[model samples]
Target: MEFSSSLTLLNSKTPFLLEKRILLLEAILEHGSISKAAKAVPMSYKSAWDAINSINNLCDNTVVLRETGGIGGGGASITEYGKNLIQSYTILQKEHTKFLEKLTTLTDFNSGNLKSLQRFTMQISARNQILAKIEAINIDKVNANIVLKTKSNQRLVSSISKNSIENLVLEKNKEVLAIFKSNNVMISTNNVKGFSARNKIKGLINKLTFSEVSCEVNILINDTDVITSVITTEAAKELELKIGQEVYAIIKSSDIMIGN
Candidate 1:
């Protein structure tokens, strides 16, 4: 048997996902039944169904054919769409394995090198990464204040250490990514008095998703940029957030982050 490795499809700029779904589809094609496919992959039937549903949502065209009651009873079949996806995945897997083989052959390969490469390719937990241009900067002995402008004319300020300023070569007009955790954003329908946060970006509520413990809200600013926020569901109800309601997304300069 030949050596093999695995890979998933994703990139830093346009994050996309596909892997087990491809495998499930391939198994369905071989077995001609969803249950059989699930068994082949050692996954629960519910999980298989969920994966199939997710794949269906991602495609405009149906990738699988299901029959409720036919001459031979209900069964599943891989459609042309699914076959094409399987073919593409098979090709990518082969190339990805070959890349891993080559990496193994490198003389200086070590655990640290592998870890560094993994971090380089892995996506961070931060959901929002807005491209902004540095408009101004203020420096003190320890910390630096960075003012950034988005394409829609909205401005944000981020505070970082003086060392970060010199390390990233940050200056006026230099393009940088302003990243902040979704949980760090505070939502308010009305401005509170004597707030300390430096940035209060006003935008319309575009979407709101609430779960038991947390609520995820998307605010549309400058008509194009969407700022995401995750807060306690209790807080969301207190604010009485609704779509089209204008709200302010408050962030501290220290909570904002910078990336090249």
Candidate 2:
């Protein structure tokens, strides 16, 4: 088997520079025109310009300089910073390639479990991430309502756009991670009816944490799973919330996100 890797620089969650953008920058340096560079990179002229603008906005210093009255109306040039960026990226890419090659050799040849590396590398701020299997999918013209079954036999539902269903390639019995934030979960002392939220799982309050403005309630739904909710301290006081008391966790289907 062969291993290859693409190097990218990110500004928080957004990508600042990638292999394709690097190629576009190189083409711009060679051709001296955005239009010619776009053609060389096989990207649209507008996309090339947008990439340049994005790079400039993310960096403290301007990277690409535009020149007027050059043969074809106007042209583009790379700054010293941009040239140094390319060289730095090239060096990093070589090291990245070497690291992946070593990783490939260490991987199990027959199993081909390289994709499993994501489980260790993936990190998010979401407090709840439940492993579930896709029990069913109800699709309409505009959206899809997915039903997921957890290991503890609890069924959770998520509502997503139809385009997302296609993009994620969701199907029955496929494993996925049901993700939601602690703040999005609502706690109820009683089985309240006529609520807009669709999901409700009854459990005992396992723990309670108090802060100046908010309270954290941890509910033990099963032997292995615990769901947490962050609610206002005023609400917690009004409800007289206590550990070991029975309560229900409520969540809206739209608030749940499905990740594979």
Candidate 3:
């Protein structure tokens, strides 16, 4: 969907060059004078002279001939070598344009099929991790609800809260990593050491949801997984969670929940 310079050469010895210089050279040859060529190419005379000087430095032969105060009054003309260079460059330019046109046609021809193939490959690979862009953060006195918009235009709603959200400085368009662990996440204090899990995700206590028999605690990790669980409010407070503190959430693949 985007176009960029794709001039790849088979050999490695070619000097670094710009296509615009060749275009300027062609215009100079066509117009027969530096001032006229500058106008024809819509460039300054200094820029045109600079390009000519660069080319002259690269090649063995002088590309342009200048006459001072002639019958036609001090004009410029391309040398024989310069004419040859322009002709070759024009041919290459035409071929390059054709190549790009062909490439575009091929891309359009297979774009739909390529997308379907990519989707099929992704399905076969069973990829679960997705990147989400945080869109809105609503922090209440006791709770916070975070709304995220994913790259694929999917919406995810996460409830956290005032103190914890403020601690992370969660804002609109911030990239927060959303991880889905199993229904239960292992929460341990910094002092509580020893974990076999590969991803020992860390966070701070964000919100507490209490029911008649059970309660849910939300742990906010840095731009990543927000582990939630049913834990006693007293236990949540006993964790000494204010606005910011350190906590760890242990998650195993078996504990990960995946969805389409």
Instruction: Give the number of the best model, judged by TM-score.
Output: 2
Arrange candidates, best TM-score first.
2, 1, 3
Candidate number with greatest lDDT: 2
Better candidate number, 2 or 3, judged by TM-score: 2
Candidate 3, which segments miss by more than 4 Å at Cα? 1-17, 69-73, 108-260
- Global lDDT of each model? 0.83, 0.88, 0.61
Looking at model 3, which ten-residue stretch has the lowest summed lDDT?
Answer: 251-260
Off by over 4 Å in 2: 1-117
lDDT of 1 by residue, 1-260 (tens): 23355566765653244677777888889988888888888688779778877777777788888765543334689889878878888888888888777766763543344444544664789987777889999998889999999876899999999999989999999877799999999988878679999999999999999999999999999798999999999999988899999999999999999987
Candidate 2 lDDT, 1-260, residue by residue in tens: 66776887777878878898889899999999988998999898779888988888888888899775554436999999999988999999989999989977887753525544555566988888877889999999898999999877889999999988889999999888889999999999999899999889888998999999999999988766788899999999999999899999999999999987
> What is candidate 2's CA lDDT for residue 254?
98
Candidate 2's displacement at residue 175, Å, is 1.1
Per-candidate TM equals: 0.54, 0.57, 0.43
Worst 10 residues of 1 by lDDT: 107-116
Q: After superposition, how far is residue 120 of candidate 3 from its true place, in Å?
A: 21
